[model samples]
Target chain A: MDKLLVSKRMKGRLVQNAILQAIFFFATVLGLIALMLLLSHVVMQAIGWLDGDFLNNFPSRRPEEAGMKSGLIGSLWLMMIVAPVSFILGVGTAIYLEEYALKNRFTAFIQTNISNLTGVPSIVFGLLGLTIFVRELGLGRSVLAAGLTMSLLVFPVIVVAAQEAIRAVPQQLREASYAMGATKWQTICRVVLPAALPGMLTGAILALSRAVGETAPLVVLGIPTFIAYLPSGVLDTFTVMPLQIYNWTGRPQEEFQHVAAAGIVVLLGFLIMMNSVAVLIRNKFQKRF
Target chain B: MGIPTNQEQPFSVREMIVENQRRQHWPKRMEKIAPKLLFTLAALSVLVTLGILFTLLFETIEFFRRVSIVEFVTSKEWLPWNEEHGSFGVAPLVTGTLLTTGIAMLFAVPIGLASAIYLSEYASERTRRIIKPALEVLAGIPTIVYGFFALTIVTPLLQNVIPDLEIFNALSPGLVMGIMIIPMIASLSEDAMSAVPNSIREGALALGATKLEVALKVVLPAAASGVIASVILGISRAVGETMIVAVAGGSSPEFTFDVTKSIQTLTAYIVQVTTGDAGYGTTIYYSIYAVGMTLFLFTLVMNVLAQYISRRFREEY
Candidate 1:
């Protein structure tokens, strides 16, 4: 009787553990399901609205006539400004910190703050943009102000990436440059940077991809919602895909929501394209060195 | 040993001295400035933080000048748009923020923890590689897209079940935020779980324990602090989320217990007031800064705490 009871208890424990494991397995599967549902719903709703006119024309009061021309052009204008400014500032700061700055308490503190800055809400960066660039500097809500705001927003991500890229150049490469009598700048520019370019570019591309989808910062900068005109210069007012999507979703009309779905598809397409570039660069560089 | 002759010298003394003197006179200034230049660039972040604090504080102080602090914090109604005298109650917004965040954690923790456990212990190497990147891809998707997904897909799916959820109820955004945050919690927890040494798991399994038992009983406790840090950080993100709540959550600010009710959050309120209606120097406009300051402080503390715990008490195997 004792033997039978022990065996029965053991069997029950085994069954309980099996059930527990099965539950966990199902949880992971649920993530894939969520992704599928999100993708399918957006793609299905977007298919009917996405067309040449939708990409080419300006936003209109009429849903059927509206297009994303202003938003597309404005976003391109913003990026044309944002991409270079962020890369130069972010990469320069990273290179200095990694290679030039003396190792001390102040340097450590700076490193900590940079990481902390990344955690601050993007909206706060919008607030800073409005205060410093828009108001203090009198730039208004032009592409320049928005571009500067986005540069700050993605600054830490790129700097951190650049630091990692720079750090990964084998010690021997730096020594070889010095052995050949290269000055500090010459060694960094010719030897360190060449090897680190792939990693730095990969990081820059990823950071810019983040800047592309941001909306809250733009909205907080008070971007006009219904601009039908394309911004032709850095000083002109502009809108991006996410802001346009936000506007469409805000409208009371059901048709606009469908348009928002289409805008999302375009935004997602841009993100995927940029990320692929980063991955491709990373793969090529990894194979070579 | 033979000494080098004058002919073997790389350069004449006169030429070498000339080049050295020229470099010392001009490039010395630039070389001296380069390190300081980089230091200034690094210091720019400090300036940014100061600017944020100053801007928020300046407007918030102006707000308090028109309205008393007691009324701003203690009022029961949040009607700043009233033509005559508006009440600036914070209860509704706070409630909505808490309600959505609570609902988010309810779903986020279990599925997130379970996914972490499965990835760390149960899955084969092939499955782990495929699922991990796929999950990370979810992290890169924008919050605005998630808001639309909540409004379009998840809400309708929930509506089919209950048939009573409000069109702009808090439940939909809350639920979708959970799905949005799953990757954060899972990824961080997976790092923590993976960091737990293999020897601990081997010991547990050798003692006649099942895999599930070993994961839940032994590994979970060992990595408890890290898992907690992940949850806290996830909460901070959910709290700071704007596009998701703003785009999907209703503009109504109501202090109620009903998840089915349409409610406004702190972030959603800021977006609505700033987007179109509010003008500069208005009471409503100033209120956004006050609210923003609150949000900034809240997220700041949570993040600092998370960073502290992850750095301070973290156990290494």
Candidate 2:
């Protein structure tokens, strides 16, 4: 009887453990289901709106006829401005902090503040953009203001990522360069940066992905909800994918909702593509290393 | 050794002096200058922080002057664009943000913590590898997609379950936000839990503790600091989340605690007000900065608290 009781208890414990593991497995599966459902719903709702003219023309008051040409162009323009500027500023700061600066109180303070700034809400940056870029600087409600605001939003993330990438470069490589009589600047430019480039690029892509989807900062920077014409210059008033989708989503018309769904599909597609590329780069770098 | 002839001599005093000066002076000068330049570059990070604070503060102060601090803080109404009268009560927006974040935490903490426990203690190596990357994929999904999911799918499902739910209420958005933030909490907490030494679990098992008991009593205690920090960071994410709230949460800025009602958050309000209504220098416009300042302070405090807790109480073993 004692032996039977022990065996039964052991079986019970096994069943319980199996159940617990199954629950966790299900939860993870549920996350995937959520993502899949979102993608499918977008595709289903947006199918009718995916025509040639839809991509070619600017937005119109008529939902059936409106396209995303201007918004797409505006987003491209914003990217052109934000991407390089953020990459340079963020990567430069990271290199200085990680490779050059002494580990002291001042550097520690700056590091802590950078992390804190990363936690600052994007809308707050929008407010900063409104006051400094839009009003004080007289950039007006233009693409330049939006791009500047977004650059601030992505800057901290890029800096953090770049710092990690730079730190990952082997210390021995730096010493080798120095022993070979390379100056500090030459060592960084030639040895450290090339080794860290892939990681830095991964961060840049991630940051840019975030910037592209950002709606709040752009909204606060006063991006127009309705722009019939393509933005012509940096100072030209603009609308981005998020703002355009937002405008359509808020409309009462059913057709407009369809258009909004289509816009979301396009936006999500772009984001997914960017992320996949980052992953590819990361994997390639890992293999090379 | 014999001395070289004058024609074959290495250098005269004048040439030697010039060569020595060129080699010694400029490099020493550059070494002195390089660090200063690099320090300035690092200092730019601090400058960025200061710039943001000063800009937000000045604009917010101007905003508060137009709308009294009392009205802004205490009043429940937030009608800034009305012609006859405009109210600047920020209470509802604050409440909405808190309520949604609270709901998000409720959903995220349990599932996320459990997942952490499972990954750290229960899962096989292959399962762990697969699940970890899958969770990261969840994190990689943009917030905009989450917004759409909340708006289209979650809202409809919630409406079916809870009668009287508005088209854009707090429940769906908060729930979706929780899902979006789960990877953050789970990943951090998993690292903390995994950091607990294997000896603790072995000792607990030797004492005849069940797997669950070992996980809960032995491992979790060791990882508490990390778990708490993860939760705080999750809260910060929920608070700062913009696209999800702005898209799904309604624009009705009311100071009510009802989760079923349409409410606006500080982020959603900033989006709404800034979209087209307010001119550049208008008081209505400066209110965006005021709202943003409040948000900035809230997240800043949370981040500082999380950092302090993690740094102060982090366990090495």
Candidate 3:
């Protein structure tokens, strides 16, 4: 009886283990298959609409005439506004928190609050933009309002990334600078900033990729769908690639699906290029030292 | 030694003048102000939270004036645009959100936890290097694309399998959302598992436990809080997700658990009301903010709980 019980226990254990292993393997395969299928599906649908004209023309009621020039330009303008605001504020916050701030309740409050803001939905940020920037500040869904919203959306992410980067900078470097009579700001500026550039850039690139893909906030901000001309300034109304794609996909027409797929390919390409750079920098330089 | 360095190096008159000038102006002025500037920047995050709170709360209060909180919270139907005597009940929207979120978590939790186990335990570093990034690409793919994928690919495929499946059902969006959040769950769970000290693994293995046993029985339990934290965060993400549900979960606001039926989430409802359909200051327009407030509170609670769990028992090795 004892022998029989022991054998049964072992068998049950073996079966359980095998089942788990199979489940895990299946899960991994599901991830791979989903990725492969998504890419191929988008590519198949996109093949027809991705062309020079698609890149050069503006949004049109006529399906074939529709293009992404204005949206692309609008995205560029948004970036122009977003890049400087986020980086300076984000990196400055990181620098202060890491180097200067005392480890106290207020600092902890800032950290916790920032982390919490990171999880707030993009739509909430949209509301903030609509209230503060569009309504209160009188920017009115222009690129400036949208860009500031995007900045706020990405700000905490950049600060967190910059903190990680700044922290990873060897302590000895800061000590050496200080030993050489450099003040706190001088030490950070001269010694830590350059060392942490690759990391900071990676964070910034990822944040930009996020900004580029965002649509809901823009939608809430009332980014007018069809613009005949490219935006010339930050105050001009604009659309983005994802927003354009969203518009296409929502239409009842069958042909617009193709355009939507093509836009996805462009957005995916943009993301892949940027992510590859981030991965390369991480793998290449981060390990060298 | 430092005092003698200038005389030993025979410091130039121009350098001496420049050094004195720099010492007098740059440090004393900028040094005093730099910290404050950075502090203000850091404090801007606090302001952002305040802004979000004020905006959500202020509008929510406005919404409540027209529609009482009791009516909004306890009513059975949500018909903000019902033309006459529209009910502003949140039950349907909340149910829809929960159903979608539930379905998503049902799919995501297992796959994500399994993948986390595989990556942290089974896969070698070389295999991990190739697979982890591939998985993360799923996370980086915009939700709009995922929404399209669900609308175009998943819903059609489901329709084929289940002929009664609605053109835009909760099932497809839920599944797509599952795939979307797999990276988040896996990465966080993997981090948690990896944090389990190797000594614990050695001890378990030395006791004649199988690798799977070590993972399932020992490491998993050891990392339970962290995994739970990640799952809560994932739940928060699933609940707050907008586009996938909006585009593929259909526009119906039904309070049903049936995944095959069409439904509208809180976010989808917001999108519907806000996309130029409702006029400013109208009840329908204010309804979105009211719903958004509910969502904000739900996610806020989940996020705080997750944060607490992750931080509460952060294991020290």
Candidate 4:
């Protein structure tokens, strides 16, 4: 009787384990399914809408004539400002914290501040851009203002990535540089920077991709969705791919939804290209240590 | 070892002196200025925080100057576009934000935790590589796409089932927002679960515990703080989300718990006001900052709480 009872309890436990595992498995499957559905749905909507004219023509009331030309160029202009500004500031900040700053209350505050900034919603950053850049600075919803806003938005991400990369450079390498009578700057420039460059590049690219997809902060900056002409300079008014897609998606016409899907395909194409570049950089320069 | 010859010298005396002066001058100036430059860059982050604070604070003060604080908080209406008889009570918007955030948490937590558990505890190496990237891709997809999906696909699908769902209801956006945040929870929780030391798992298994028992009872408890932090962060993300709600959540500011009806969130309100002509210094204009302040505070509290919980309860190996 005791043996029979013990075996029965064991069977029950086994059944419970199997059931729970299946539940977990299905949960993961659900996420993948959602991804597939989103992709397929967008692709289906984009079937005939994604073409050369779609990329070349200006946005219009007519769906067939609407193109992302101004948006595509405007995005490039935004990147021109965002890329250098964010990279220099973000990497410089990381180098200061990791290589220079002593561990104390001040550094601690900076660290906490950065993490908190990361948590601040992108929309709040939009408010900041609206007040400081667009209104106070008189940037007037221009590409430069939008770019600066995006720079601040992605600043923490790039800093965190650079810090991790700097931290990963072996201490022994630094010591070797010092033993050769190198100064702090010399050691950092010669030894640490080289080793950390690839990681920093990867991080910066991923962060920039995020900038490319960002629409909220730009919307808050009052970036117009109906710019027919491409921005000729940084100070010119601009729209981006995501914002264009948003404008399309919100239209009452059903055909505009397909245009939005096409815009999504293009925007996603850019993001995937950027992400794969990051991945390529990581794989090419990944050190075993 | 032989005496150095003039022909073997790589530089003339003038050249050597010039190079030495150049090096000394450049490095000395850079060594002095580089730290300060970098420090200035680092300080920009603090300036950003201060900028956000003062911008929100000043505009919010301007808003409160026109509207009574009591009415702003206690009243249930949120119509600010009507210049004459517009109501500014934020309660309806708060309720809308809460309802949507609640729904999002409900949908995300279980699926996210389960995926984390499956990835960390059950999946093999190959399966994990495939599954993990797939989830990352989900995370990487822009929120605008999700907003479009919510508006175009999810709402229609739900309307078919519920038959009473509005074209722009809270349910679709909330669920889609939940999907947008699942990766955050799954990735962070998986990191926490994976950090659980191997010895605990081994000990549990040696006691004849089932795999699920070991994962749930042993690893889950050990990483509880981190798991909680991820959830709080997810909540924060949902609260701050603007595009999904702005796109799919209807613009009606109503005080109702019914998920089938249209409601306006604080973020959606800000988008509406910004996109329209609120004009500078109008009550409608300043009200955006007031609403933003509310949104900012909600996210700030959640983030601080998450940070506190994670740091306070962190278990060291």
Residues B1-317 of candidate 4: C-alpha lDDT, one tens digit per residue: 34547674446789767766875897878888888999999998899999999999999999999999899999888878766788899998988888889899999999999999999999999999998988988888888989999999899999989999999889999999988888899999999999999998999999989999999999999999999999999999999998999999989999999999999999989899888887998998999999999999989999999999988998888
Give the per-residue lDDT of model 1 (tens digit) for B232-295. Answer: 9889988888888887789889878799989998888888887876877788888888888878
lDDT of 4 by residue, A41-155 (tens): 9999999999999999999999989999988888889889889999998999999999999999999999999999999999999999999999999999898999999999997
Query: Could you tell me which residue pairs clash in candidate 3?
Result: none
**How do the candidates rank by TM-score, highest first?**
4, 3, 1, 2
Sorted by lDDT (best first), the order is 4, 3, 1, 2
Off by over 4 Å in 1: A1-11, A287-289, B1-12, B16-30
lDDT scores for all predictions? 0.86, 0.84, 0.87, 0.92
Instruction: For candidate 2, report its TM-score.
Output: 0.91
lDDT of 3 by residue, B1-317 (tens): 26645444537888777777865696768889999999999998899999989898999999999888999878888877778878988999988999889989998999999999999988889989888878877788899999999999999998889999998789999999999988899999999999999999999989868779999899998898899999999999999899899889988898788999999999888777667657778888777788888888888999999999988887767
**Predicted model with the maximum TM-score:** 4
Chain A TM-score of each candidate structure, as shown: 0.93, 0.95, 0.95, 0.98
> Model 3 over residues A1-289: C-alpha lDDT tens digits?
5999988887888888788888887897697798788889989998978999999999898888889888888888888888888988899999999999999999999999989988898887887888799889999869999999999999888999999999899888899999998888788888898888888878887888888888888877778877888776778787888888888988999899998898888888877887899878877767334
Cα lDDT tens digits for candidate 1, A59-149: 9888888788888888788888889988987888898899997899888888887877877888777777877898889999899999999
**Residue B240 shift from truth in candidate 1, angstroms:** 0.6
Q: Please compute DockQ, using alpha carbons, for every candidate against the native two-chain complex.
A: 0.59, 0.53, 0.72, 0.85
Name the runs in model 2 displaced over 4 angstroms: A1-11, A287-289, B1-37, B79-86, B206-208
